[model samples]
Target: MKPEKLSDIKKELAGRTVQELTEICLRIAKYKKENKELLNYLLFDSDDPLLFSEKVKTFLEEDFKAMQKHYYHSTKSLRKILRIMNRYAKYTGNKQVEVEFSLWFCTNFLHYADLNTSHKPLQAIFIRQLEKISRLLPKLHEDLQFDYQGEFETLLHKADSQARWVSKSLYL
Candidate 1:
């Protein structure tokens, strides 16, 4: 079945009392993980997006630390971690959080999963995510875009400079 449009949903919800809305939201959250995560963010984490992003980063770091070091396993594990991070980013639907999460992913990928460059598929995955982060940057407010642009530029430069080094070290 087709879902109702967001505007229609908003109009209907506008007439709801606080308790009614809470009950409806709780019922929705009962059946879907994404719904629950979104509700949790709106209720508790929305007040401090930076903290939420940092918490996600910590989770990413832990996942990275637990990853198998073999190149084949590393690529698969990185993809899984990135998928989880993207889900958290979607729960917020916040551009700043997206950029921050992407930056954190890139940093962790480069530092802990340097072997990404050793395999063409892994390198392509890294580049694709960089492209996605670039796309997201333009969607932020002008001030935030400018600030994040600087960070992306630095990341791009590092990725480019490290490519050759990563290739050379492939046999080590």
Candidate 2:
């Protein structure tokens, strides 16, 4: 999506009820999951970590740019959301949201290159940071307090649980 389009989406989102916002967020999550699944297939099947990493990096860069285009306004709720995402990115050794692109790139590369053994520490660090961010989602939803806040919190918890499962699976 173009930056202008994303900005328009953000504006539209701002006017929505909490329930609407939660629905939109769920859609976004679905999109991300679908994209990630496709990426995984490409990475694992192609046996080309470097190429996969480059593609992931490009995708992440675009996503970060889109997020940046929607700079939070003078609203506490919007500010909190942006802050949470920013902190999450920082905790994951990402200086900017765009860094997720690079990190994912590196992760795929490591996995394909059989570098996982050597990169376990880095992977653990990333997962821990993601966990922290996942834990903060409920607080963020509470602060926003739309009618579906509870449902959003539940979603966040599920995401956290899934993250924990993935972390343990990777280690084991």
Candidate 3:
């Protein structure tokens, strides 16, 4: 079935009473885990995005420590962690948070894993995330962009040295 447009949904929601909206939100939250998570973030965690991101960083640190040494297994877990980070970024709708998560992910990826593998898929993940951050940097405010650019450049240099496949010039 086709879903209603966002405008139509907004209009209908605007007509809802406070109790009705709460009931609707509860029903939606019960239908999906992601819906529940988004609601939780909006209601509670939305006030302090920096704090939320720090909690995520701590969670990711544990996840990274748990990652398997095998390339195939590590790749699967890494992508799963990436999905979680993406979800948090989507919930916040904040560019700085996304960049923060991306940088943290890349830094831990390089530090925790030995990217010295002869193949390229994991290196590809690292490179893709860096590219994603580079694309986002321009959209941020000048001070934030400058602050993050230094970190990004540092990641670039580290990535270039770690994985044989990544070329520093491509991202620069």
Q: Which 10 consecutive residues of model 1 have the lowest summed lDDT? A: 163-172
lDDT of each: 0.81, 0.41, 0.90
Model 2, which residues run further than 4 Å from truth? 1-118, 142-172
Ranking by lDDT: 3, 1, 2
The backbone clash count of each candidate, in order, is: 0, 0, 0
Off by over 4 Å in 1: 165-172
**Residue-level lDDT tens digits of model 3 in 11-129:** 99999999999999999999999999999999999999989999988988889999988888888888989999999899999999999999999999988776878647777788789
Q: TM-score winner among the candidates? A: 3
2 versus 3: better TM-score goes to: 3
Q: Of the candidates numbered 1 and 3, which has the greater TM-score value?
A: 3
Per-residue lDDT tens digits for candidate 1, residues 1-172, read: 9999999999999999999998998999999988898898889999898899998888778889988877788889988998889999887778899889888888778778764346876786777778788788889999998888888777777776766533322211
* Alpha carbon lDDT at 156, candidate 1: 71
Q: For candidate 2, write residues 18-88 as lDDT tens digits.
A: 99876765665577755445444444634543444455456444433333221122122323333444433
Please provide TM-scores, in order, for all candidate models, with all chains considered together: 0.82, 0.23, 0.95
State in Å the error of residue 76, model 2: 35
